[model samples]
Every structure is written in structure tokens, then in C-alpha cells.
Target: MKLQDSVIAITGGGQGLGRAMAEYLAARGARLALIDLVPEKLEAAAEACKAAGGDARAYTCNVAREADVEATFASIIEDFGQLNGVINNAGILRDGLMIKARDGEISKRMTLAEWQAVIDVNMTGVFLCGREAATKMIENGDKGVIINISSISRAGNMGQSNYSAAKAGVAALVPVWAKELSRYGIRAMGIAPGFIETEMTASMKPEALEKMSAGIPLKRMGKPEEIASAAAFIIENDYMSGRMIEVDGALRL
Candidate 1:
């Protein structure tokens, strides 16, 4: 719970929100296990975490693969000698409308492959990693937390049927994990971010970004550090569990 020396594993820690959290938590003295599919990115992130004033190591693994998830968690525990928390943050965006039609005639439909890909990484990946993390925490007698990275698009946004479904599924798991893991002193929580200015959004045209920002009550996109701050708060607040913290600038999908 205390950031000082608490060992936390983060998926997708190579960049974006994951990297931001790694640095933020590291700055507060938490040890980090930065997991990602890309070895280079993981190495860089781990170094960055160390620069932020905490110990950190990198692991390369695919969250969508059960074997990878299992081995990764095991390795984390073996290296860190204790496990405290895991942030399920690895995800991919494959945005497309379920059906594209004009005058009732369908021009295109979301492919099964497309849907399955997102579900595998965004939904099932969370399941595998969360399961393995909780198991390790309990076996090691470490009280910890699980934080799922969801999105406001979980409310069902246009042009994102696959992503919406995947995010919604993870968000729904918050309560289930909390109720199940609480007996072992492990807590579960979720964060549903609205429009945030990450690498993905940073490349958008200025006009489009302005239009998107206009809808948010804050009239601006969120920063990755802000989301990281929310995550740190959740980990430190022992009483908070089974809740989804919306950092959306009051914007509704």
C-alpha cells in the first residue's frame, strides 16, 4: 500500500499510460516490474523508472497468452522476491463500426478476426494477468491490488464496437475481483479514462483534437500523468476497492 519499496508489475509499461505510471510510482519509491512485448521499450522504461528514484526491471511478454502471463508473473516474483500489485494496462485499438451501411444496404461489417483480436488482448489478457498476479500475491503472502485500465468508450462509442466491448468487460470485472480477492487482502479497481492526450491522440490533426476537446467539460484532454496519479491514489487508499474511477473531465460518452 505504501509506495515505498512496494513491488508493482505493470503491463504495457513500455510507453503511454503504462510508462507514465511506472515513472510516477517509481518517483514515490515503489519498485517496478515493467512488462511489455517489446524488449527495447521495456528496457528503456525500466531505466526511466530507476531514474525516477526507485528500483525497476523489465520483462518482455505477451499478456494475451496464458503461458506468457503465467511465466511473466512467476519471473516477477522470482526477481522482486515479493509482489504487491499489477496494473492491467496493455491494450490495442482496432476501431471500426460493427456495420457500415447506406440506405439500409451494408457496405462493411466488423470481421470476427477484428473482434477476436481486441477481445483477446484487451479482455482476456486482463483475465490471465490478473489471475496470475493474484495467485502469486496470495502464495507469497503479499497483500496487493489489481488495477484494470478501462476507458470511457466502455459506454459504447461509435466506430469502436470491439474496443467498447473489451473495455466494458474489464470494467465489469472490478467488483468480481474485489469480492473474490478481498479475503486474501487483495483489492481490485478500475480506471475509465475519457479522452486523454497520449501518443495516439497526440498525432491527431489539430482541428480534430480541438473538436474532441470541446465536448469535454474541462475543454481539454487528460494527461497520462493525471491517470497515473489516480492509480497511485487507488493503490494507497486501502479502503477503496471494486470501484471504477472516471477521470474523464466530466465528459460522457
Candidate 2:
């Protein structure tokens, strides 16, 4: 798909990587539908996209809710007239080990709420948004792309049982959607990002960030623009479906 004049919808577009991607793609001449929960952040991100050299509109949405996703995508298509792509980028982190024990004795276990919260936002939200985007794209006869933002933690990370599980689920959907949507000229892909310089990671302690960065082969965290560049490449390349592009500076979980 060409970036020029393309209509791309992004979840979690209020800030961080989602906003970075919106600006990156917008600069390439694509129109954007920026979706997020915060009205103020969405408006700011939309304005930023417009300032980046393309048109953009803000839509407040809760991607985890089916009704919100359906309505948001419909509105995107209604407003843009043609849907070209969507990025399932909305996610939440509920970090905790499933079981916390001292000396093999019972201590604390991850609550159901912790697990469910992450699953609802990260995994279920991806499914809901992907379904709505595909439906809209098919109805409009647009050859579009769906990019799911997975994570290196999908490989399984300590202290992140819920996050890892949700990430893994989204990663698995890439090939499934690619095969299922191929007939309609729609492509599906995943991006498993390692630690990056986002608001979430930026809030970590300096020593924690330094230690984490040292573990990566590149000895530094990735930039949001780096991930955004990978997303842009996926949208621009026609035959790059059913696979994930990891932008982790060669880091592995």
C-alpha cells in the first residue's frame, strides 16, 4: 500500500509510540484517524499529526470494548471515505508474577484482576480493533494492512505473566489474519518491540533503565521513531505479511 493519501487508523494514538507512528506516517502524506481514551491527548496528537504535513482527526475510543471499536472504525471509514490500514497499538501493563513464594511456601499470587486487566486491554483490544478494521477495509475494497504491536516479552518474561501472555496471543494472530485476509488484499503483521524510550520506560529509575539498556546488544533502548519506521516499512511493502519485525536493537527475551 502507498502511504500517499492512505487512511490509517491507530489505537493509543494520544502519545508515545502510537503518536510517533501517527506523525511518521502523516509526514509521508497519509491521513490518520487517531484513537485514544483521553480527549485532550487525542486532540493534541491529532494536531501534531496535522503539523507533520498530513491530515488527521481525533476519535475518543476504548479499544477493549467491542462497541467502541466497531463504532470508531465505522466513523473512521465514514470520515476518511476509504480505509487503508490500522495499527492495534493500545496496550496496558499489569506486571506481576503468577506466584510469589518464599522458600517454596505460599506467599502471594497474582490476582485474577491483574491478569484479566492486561488481557482485556492488550489481547482482546487487538482482536476487537483488528476485526473492525478488516471489516471496514473489506467493505470499502481497500487493500490495507493491520499492524499489531507485540513485545519481546511475548517470549516469556519474569514478573510479567499477564503481559507476556497477551503479547504472545497478539503475535499469534498475525499469521492467522494474514492467511484469512489475503483474498481481500489485506495484509497482517506484528511488531515485537523490545524496551524503547517511551513514557512507560522513561518513568523507570535511571539505574534500572541503564541496567536494562546494557543487556541489549546495542547497549541502548530503541527510539519510538525506530519502531515507527518499522511500521512504515510494513505499510509500504506489499509482500511483507504474516511476519513480525522486531525493533529491539537485537535484544532477545
Task: Kindly list the per-residue Cα lDDT of model 2 for residues 102-205, writing each as its tens digit.
Answer: 98897889999999999999999999999999998899888899999999999999999999999999999999999999999999999999988999988999
The positional error of residue 75 in candidate 2, measured at the CA in angstroms, is: 0.6
| RMSD, every candidate, angstroms | 0.9, 1.0
Report, for every candidate in turn, its global Cα lDDT versus the true structure.
0.95, 0.94
The lowest-lDDT stretch of 10 consecutive residues in candidate 1 is 244-253
Count the clashes in each prediction. Answer: 0, 0
- Pairs with backbone N, CA or C atoms under 3 Å apart (clashes), candidate 1: none
Query: Per-residue error at 137 for model 1, in Å?
Result: 0.5
Residues 25-122 of candidate 1: C-alpha lDDT, one tens digit per residue = 99999999998999998899999999999999999999999999999899999999999999999999888889999999999999999999999999
User: Over all chains combined, what TM-score does candidate 1 have?
Assistant: 0.98
